[model samples]
Target: MSLLNNVFYFQNGIGVLANVFLLLFYIFIILCHRPKPMDLISCQLTFSHTVMLLTGGVVWVTDIFESLHVDNDIKCKTSFYINRVMRGLSICITCLLSMFQAVTISPSTSFLANFKLKLKKNIIYAFFYICSLNLSLYSYLIFYVGGLTNVSETNQMKVTKSCSLLPTNYIIRALNLTVTTSIDIFLVGVMLVTSAYIVLILFRHQRQHKHLHSLSHPRSSPEKKATQTILLLVTFFVVMYWVDFIISSTAVLLWMYNPVIQSVQKFVLNVYPTVTPLVQISSDNRIIKILKNIRSKYHQIL
Candidate 1:
């Protein structure tokens, strides 16, 4: 195999394996709890991550096959649409996670804090809204995307086997890329700010002198663990997303013409869905509980 094909095969293999374990691990966590607020949200995130992984895997495999001179038109289109859809859903759900966490941590007397109690029941509905909004926004724009057979040098669009977006009005393309990148930046920024604030608030409340200290009494509060997990999640999101965004944005700026960089950017963006499960598995309570229980029993027998 060519060096690029060999590299992608190994990388995508690792991602697929990691995501499989994550799906199982998160499902275990979901089942262990009595359907708590956070448990439900975590479940949704895991499910979305699985979809992301599957679509990403298909895209990766398709690339490898194309490299080997195998062309499958139906598979290519399916892979393209599925990848885009899952990516949109994943982004929407992550944003929802941030919003939900912010609401959960809001001061008890705040007007929006009332929704905390309703979160377990209402989060799925909120997710649906986010999905719908994404679908609507992407639907029109993706019309501009089609197979290579559809590409032409003429004023309109052309489609063939491989999905190639022909050059459009420079002003319009610039505006679209600018808007898309800006929205991504804004959403990621919101997630970072809210998660950071939650972490700080938790720290402050743990101080005995603060009025909020009583709210964080050790027995009833999962503040420390929850904050730690959310912070890790936000950090992973920022790092993985910026890798993808920066590459994509650079391509858009550099005349949108570099194939090799485009391939690498795609690889980087695809890695996160699989890697994300590892983050979740480490942060999950069920897995930790199982490990601790195993250790405790071992000690007793010893």
Candidate 2:
């Protein structure tokens, strides 16, 4: 058990470090470059990943303390709620990225072209709305979740490190699950559909324009490249989302019999945030160019 806990801690530490680097890099990009629609969305996504990873790390560390019999109710609940909000925000941002890319790449004659133009103009407003919606939706956790407690035979008060949802009737539980699941399904569905559409559009365009480029030059256009990147991001998000969902949905049944399910669930939840930053950096040519230039400059100075 100690060895397993150490492994979890090490994984969480690496995720936190990766997210921190992403945060710094995105901030620098925003400050140094003219912020386009894609840039704004990328910045938002990076920020979301940073917060999600940080809160996840806090929760994992708290769990370790919890295993040691340290009691910190408020810290546990706070981190839990914050992590939930950040997780929702991460999903929303990924959906936004996929939707934006789909709209941007639609053909001029397509019906979505007009909406794409308008969306590009008001993407910042859309992003703000998404952030607000996620915060508001997940805010319920603050009121409904708290640390478990136990009373000693000697009449002493004891708080457990684990959090417990407040007692609620079946209706409330069903309603909460419905709402959360609905939103998740809707956003994920949108991401998958739009990403597929973007790929189709890119494929058709490439076939039509194949004669324009030389045989030796097989590189795709910048837009097509970016669309491919967004598709990859959506794919990763979908896999992680479903894996976590399955584990969580069946957790009650499996948790008591198989303790490893909880660990796997936690790992699946954190994997996307840890890897997203690296994916974003690799997909963006500008970011890659800047990083390479920095590396060369450092080497020359050395």
Candidate 3:
């Protein structure tokens, strides 16, 4: 019932709800409606976000697991492992989504256009690969510390906001950090590159549309709308991610733990997933049309 606890619960609750809503919506689309190209990927991203929120606060939410009489060490390890894995997936999947949208909007003359066929064919495989890789990479955390933390190590990471989650040799710590940061940088770099490509294509497309139709507000195609949404998502994610990454890297390297800084970092971590669904709900024409139809039907029944 502390202020930080309240904030954490609120943020995680909002994030979990938003992600679950989108998860169900995406599933409904895939099952009952004509699925959009982004549906499966978005669904996977939402599921990752939901699990991230639930597991990210394991230290604080341990009461839920305590019912099963799980040890505190086990709780911390579970949280650390899942949180890291989901964080990895979030970046990888966001990069993939941005790259796919770029390809979707690319002109036939563009080089990205050639990959469209192959990308669509292999998209599911890409998801599976990302999941398998993250699961394998972050699984080390659960065992890397040898079950319990070494409080004696000054370089122990204050993960799960309070748990000294990772304690190992400097060499191992450095190696893990290097590997994780390298993968994150590679994924984020992909997002940035594809986002820039998308923005340029959108600008050129808008100009062409205006020139052809001589209209002030040219209507956008569905592909253009989807591209814009993905761009916005990538931008929001990069901004949030860099904030969290800078703080986390600084803490992990320096072995510094400030309560307030960790709190802020936790908030930054949840912001992207919480806001993404709202953005998609508002921007997605299908969601809007569905809401409008439901409203009309309710009004008629009333």
Candidate 4:
């Protein structure tokens, strides 16, 4: 294998493994443990990330579609479609998580407190709504992506070795970009607002604690830790999202993907999914406790 292929596969394997582990952990929480409000959202995010990473380029790179006699164009369209849907779901649910956490930490009399009950009740509905929204929003991909039959083609934007972006009407492409960018910006904006709200609440609580000299409350509340985790996640996601978005926009405009640029873009596109599970594992106390237990058990067995 080429060095590039090795690197891509390695990154994807790590991401897929981490995401699967995290997905199973969240499932266990729902079935065996009392799940939190944000647990459902986390489950959705992890599942989406897993699918996205898996579909990123594994089949095309492995020539599995050819071996199975699958049409190259169908593989291209399917992979791109699934990847985009999962990407959209990741951002949407991340925003939902942030908003839910903000509501969770709101004081009883605060305006956001009223939505807490409503959000938890409608969480499943929210999932369906986003699934439908993204499914519709990214439908243009099926039209604009196809198997690259000729490497000599100049106008096509090569996304992977097997498929490239086909040309479409200028107006349609422009509208799609506008709508996609608007949706992404709106979601990121909501995350930022919620993050600021959480930070403000944390600051106020700190002041209140200092004023009261509450020696008994030395540890931060669970809500505080959860909000902090969400804030960190949102911040990292925004950075990765914008970087990927910029590269994607450039690809659309240029209508040609250079070899080096394509590799970089692929890496950038998948970075958020790869990093997300690691961040969750590090931040979540439950995962830490589980790891500790596993470690102690291993020692005992030894």
* lDDT (Cα, tens digit) per residue for candidate 3, span 1-302: 27976787788887887788888889988999887668888888888888888887734467777788887777777777888888889889899899888888788998888999999889899999999999998988877532345556555655543367555666776788899999998899989998998888778877887788865444356766777788899999999999998998888777676777888888899898888888888888888998999999999999
How far residue 49's Cα lies from its native spot in candidate 3, in Å, is 0.5
Question: Cα deviation of 141 in candidate 4 (Å)?
Answer: 0.9
Name the top TM-score candidate.
4
Q: TM-score for all predictions?
A: 0.75, 0.84, 0.90, 0.94
Local accuracy of candidate 2 as per-residue lDDT tens digits, 44-65: 8777777776666555566666
lDDT of 1 at 115: 81
Model 1 weakest 10-residue run by lDDT: 152-161
Model 2: CA > 4 A from native: 59-71, 151-161, 211-220, 252-258
**Candidate 3 similarity to native, TM-score:** 0.90
In model 2, pairs of residues that clash are none
Which order, best to worst by TM-score? Answer: 4, 3, 2, 1
RMSD of each: 5.1, 4.5, 2.6, 2.0
What's the true lDDT of residue 62 in model 2?
A: 65
Which 10-residue window in model 2 sums to the lowest lDDT?
151-160
In terms of lDDT, model 4 sits at: 0.87
Which segments of model 3 are wrong by more than 4 Å?
Answer: 58-61, 145-157, 216-220, 299-302
Segments in model 1 whose C-alpha atoms lie over 4 Å from true places: 1-7, 25-33, 57-74, 107-112, 149-161, 209-223, 289-302
How many steric overlaps are in each model, in order? 11, 0, 0, 0
State residue 165's C-alpha deviation in candidate 2, in Å. 3.1
In order, candidate lDDTs are 0.65, 0.74, 0.81, 0.87
Compared with the true structure, what per-residue lDDT tens digits does model 1 show for residues 120-194? Answer: 577778778866766665563455554565333533332222555545677877787786677677788888877
**Residue 63, model 2: Cα distance from true site in angstroms:** 11
